[model samples]
Target: MPIQNPLKKGSRDPYVTIAQQQLIALGYGLPRFGADGELGDETLFAYGTFLVSQGLRAPTDERPKSITPAGTAALDKAFAALAQGGSTANIIDERHNHPHSGRSVSMPYRPWPKITAVVLHQTATKIGEKPASWHGVPIHFGITRAGKIIQLYDLTEVCNHANGLNRPSVGIEIDGWYAGIEGRPETLWQPKNLSTPRQPMNFPTAQAEAAMTIVQWIVNAVAANGGRVTHIHPHRQSSKDRQSDPGSLIWQTVGLWAQNTLGLSDGGAAFTVGNGRTIPEAWDARYTGNRY
Candidate 1:
């Protein structure tokens, strides 16, 4: 059962009211009639589930219904596990984040606010890339080589990563150079932070784990937001040969997680909205049809 808005307190909205109900039926009660889609007692049941999944004791905290950042990670961990057709984990791995962030707003897709897809990208620039935007990181979330998932801002706010296609998408940037072997069009340009023995520039275990968890959370959030985006694409696919980010390892790793585990549409496919693909075509051409 996916954790909808009412699944946690102070959340935005709840789409799968039954997700909460299932928790309650399964002894993870948030509150009866939790489908009301508002934060209330039922949130505690979900929170407790989060704690239990994290391998922690039941909450004795003053406001047990309250969800800390850690609590959200636990919940996301559980969701990711279940989404992939696996049982809930006894614990969710930890995720790192940036301290500052911008305001969040739902994609409210042009025709209507909705979840069209989860778009992926690479920093292209350093993690702390120069010529920074006053708005914050262009990508909604970033995964560091150390497995840190930095939340630059709420998913609701738009960033520069996806270019014109930002309206119906949720963009994520993973650390390290996602550009392929030949690299980007810029001949002089090169990845500033390539890891050791790096050929594919793979994601570290911690980052990979956190990414899997977060992608699940993002998918659910999109479902809650009206279900417009269901697939995952590379950043380059969203632009006119202008960008090529979120390299193969990310596609193979996170894309497989979305498809095999979550049973989502092919993240490597060239899903077009207007002129852009949901992601890049380069890596997708190779990784598509093959399990990562």
Candidate 2:
């Protein structure tokens, strides 16, 4: 079925179906819904994310929006990018296990004795820039704004992501800074802090979906390797005295989604709106001191 009406929420249009098919093929597919073609939250989020990955502005509203001609052009670009062997998921080649040269964490993470938790982090710097000069690429994986997942390190070892919990946690960094970082006038991972009313962060629909894929991948990896993740923690949740990297609202959304939908463990919430379990600042310590 061709797009009969502008693709909006709750429509059963076949064009919505076609768009969903294309999005999934480009690696922006919905995990749970799987191109059922209903134009639901997962499908729209993926569609919006794909548009954003092309650097096109996509509205954050849940109401359905019509796809423009330029949207088609971007999809063409995405397919071309994929044709060249581009992928959103990867793992470091096992042979280069000795911490290959680009950057290092405060201290090398010991191989995970057992992965009991998944700790999420943000680069806290612009995408494509090295975050290591400060925090050290400390994450096991890094997801880019365009939705590609790069394996920074072979996650068998722990990196200094969480100050004290490295041994039992696996850290994954999604590219981009959190909202409210005073230095960044823009390019925040989200436009609104999911947990608080701070400066807008503007997380792309694509990046959010990319993050969920990475987290689920980690969970599956742990389960396969004779370990099972018991909790999912964000950088802010584990950062007792450290910089709050992954921020609040995004992580909360991810953690809850994983638990309620995917059956992953929800150790507990890191922070809540006005609850104040969070460190008072969003700046990474590597960039500033006592951000609080």
Number of the predicted model whose lDDT against the real structure is largest: 2
State the lDDT of candidate 1 residue by residue for 48-148, as single tens digits. 65576567655454346554555544544554554353323122222223333332344332432555667777665546422132225655676666655
* Per-residue accuracy of model 2 over 1-292 as CA lDDT, tens digit each: 1232355567775445446545765678577975464767887777778777666876555533665556655664554343233223453333244454432355443444377887777766556633333233555676666666666566676565566556677777766666434335452444344675334444555666666777777777777777777776656555543334565434533544455445655343234222223433332212223334
Candidate 2 yields a Cα-based lDDT of: 0.56
Give the whole-model CA lDDT for all candidates, comma-separated. Answer: 0.51, 0.56
What candidate 2 gets wrong by more than 4 Å, as runs, is 1-113, 129-136, 180-200, 241-244, 269-292
How does candidate 1 score on lDDT?
0.51
TM-scores, all models, native as reference: 0.50, 0.51
